[model samples]
Target chain A: MTPLPDAPAAPTAPRQPARRLRRFSRAERWVHRGTAWLMGICVFTAACLYLPPLSELVGRRRLVVTVHEWSGLMLPAPLIAGMFFRALRADLSRLNRFGRHDWHWLRTVLRKRSKEGVPAGKFNAGQKLYSAFIAGAVLVMIGTGLLMWFTHLAPVLWRTGATFVHDWLALLLAAGITGHVWMASKDPEARLGMRTGSVASWWARREHSLWKPDDKD
Target chain B: MEEPRVDDAPDDPGEENERHGAPVGRRVVLGMLGLGAAGVALGSHVQDRIDAVLAEVSAKDPTGVTGLLPGGGGFRYYSVTSSVPKRNAENYRLTVGGLVDRPMTYRLADLQAMPQQRLVHDVQCVTGWRVPKTAFSGVRLSALLAASGVRPEATAIRFDCFDGAYTESLTLQQARRSDVMVALTMQDKPVTHAHGGPVRLYAAPMYFYKSAKWLSGITLTKSVEPGYWEKLGYDVDAWVGKSNGRSDDPTS
Candidate 1:
């Protein structure tokens, strides 16, 4: 997709209609989509494994287990690969910074009368928190999952503990993802931004008031 | 004169009896009924039903996913082959031959009629998981060997299963351990097919793989023969604590 310059629409025109601004770059969208696909397979196979009724219906527990394990092992691959992309690195830095407005945004966004969101950058506080949780969760799940799959590598007590942690953390992660999806549904612009790597300039101006289309690393 | 007072007395004694005796009698009856209900609830019949349900569920799950979760003694159903041929009492047979003075064949009924030894031991799998205090009852392997009269040249006993793929062996010394048996019952009930029932070997001191399931033949060999899993890199002597390079507690 061709990116438009943020220059004033036309010198002859007094005021311009809303423009499309770059939100997620092509590399960022690729990373996000790839991670989502792998995580989806992991979740589906995990359901087949953890639910007895579903296991019976599926009748290929071995295959489900193999798919779950491999997908989980590969969960961080996209993020690692995307580090080479300059745009993704820049976006990651933006996600890492937490400004005063973010804390204010988190505090006031839930209030009944707070229609206009607190000024945010390319990423908001909630998004950052979610990203942090997911990153930590993926690491923990992979560690415990490896202990379970490779029982010979650890003691019985360690393996047992791993199983316990793996099972419980999976439930929490699932709930967190559900909330993430719910929040995403509320902002179609954000979803479209992820999909097409651009968002309506007016939408960005309202949600991420501090973001500028011309800003670059 | 005394007989006149003996008539149904409506006195303090009778009132006291009425006050305490009726409720106490009712309570005793209720207590007895509660005990009876408990006995039935914890009885073999309920245990049998539980075993059946577990077997049915595990059977439906080929990968033994249920075994990964806690409960039901943590036993994973493992079979080397995709499908195992089912053996029942009417069709089941055990042949003891090879390097024996008297080759003998026994039916399910014959094995049941022999003296049975019951064992309560933990079942440890090589892949890691222990089901503690599982009960297995059957004729002792030593008894079977003695009856067949082992030949002087025989040094090991190789056991075969109706599953058609599995074979396990133990040294004559190991086989003669009082703990080893040809198991007919498990968990206080006839072993369900899912758990390898009717007749199977029980090597109490070794990893469960040594206790071959769906056992069909017993051959006395001149030397120790590695069994199914052993051929695939599992230790031939799968003693719980001493073998398999694992330091887990012994099944015994």
Candidate 2:
């Protein structure tokens, strides 16, 4: 091919490197990971406590109970600690709000329609919903768990109600987390964002179109 | 490709206000925590109401799920029957009969007046809650058996309850163990009515269920008869750590 026309002269201007957008702060990532680890322990220990086969298999029942209780009691610690970080506070503010776009996004998601370029911020509508539910669930679980732990603090019916709610809600939470994991597995870019606190600029634009990374970050 | 630029953030007033505001949400959470503490502090009225509701629910809940959760303390209240009549010093009587030289009915005071033994042992429930180092004082079953003069033909001891439902048994050898007693006081106080009080059996080496509650009678038998829970598939020989397919540390 005539040596590709002697290789036309390359442009003199320096090409800018592809940018990496900051998706999560270090504080946010640590909070997420810490909460995840504690939640994992809680779930595992709860399974060992409730399931007969598991309970029998893991014979140190008293230790299992102690681990489960302490892990559950510590679930809120990371989130509460994250409040001191401005970035996390800003993100929490974002998560707590439900804008017109968010409602539309939710409606479209429920309709099973294309969600391409849905104008999600740092977090999507699904993520916002998940955060709300998880926050509420964590609080409720802690309250009920406290009642279960300090058995003498509450009466028979309250403890009964707490157990009933705790058991059923825990099942729901486990299911929700399974779905959350499945979604995370499907999106390697999102997983990278959570893991590294950053994502490719193009990916951010395509996914969280409304997200505006702070220059200071 | 067009260069994407950062947009001015905190666009929404709600988000802006939440970021700048004095963390009202966190305050709400802290307030809830405080309210929970207060609820526990002033829970007597709530306790009564809850107990009333529990009684109603217990009447209807056949599975006894209502009774499975731990009560005020660590103990789970399990009554096989729908309701147990409350027994106290005025009406409580423990009868020792069957295969004995002298069958005798004794009042609560008589047992209290007899030589008393105190035991501090872990109370283990087969379903798996333990109250460690619990103090129980009562007349030993062996002492009562010796007083009644158990006949030579008797091989086992059967326990009866005022609840009209629960029953328990122990081999003659098990009944004679120094650890086993007819528990009169628990935690240094007269066993409350809720705790199978006025009088109850306390088998220190066995599970709490084996310590028959609302104890009413002690009968000598020719063979070992399984107790109420034993009939329902619990181990007949429910020695902590050694029986019931479990290996937990022995309570004694």
Top-lDDT structure, candidate number: 2
- Model 1 residue A13 CA deviation in Å: 14
Candidate 2's C-alpha runs over 4 A off are A1-17, B1-252
Task: Report the CAPRI category for model 1.
Answer: incorrect
State the lDDT at B138 in candidate 1: 94
Worst 10 residues of 1 chain B by lDDT: B13-22
Residue lDDT tens for model 1, B1-252: 011132222233221121221222223334444433343234333433544576568657878765544333355566555457778889999999999999999999999999998999988876555676899999999999999999999999899988778889999999999999999999989988767888889999999999998899999999999987778677888889887656777777
DockQ of model 1, rounded to 2 decimals: 0.01
Q: Spell out the clash pairs found in candidate 1.
A: none
Q: What TM-score does candidate 2 get on C-alpha atoms? A: 0.51
lDDT of each: 0.74, 0.76
**Per-residue lDDT for B228 in model 1?**
79
RMSD of every candidate to native, in Å, equals 21.4, 15.6
| Pairs of colliding residues, candidate 2 | none
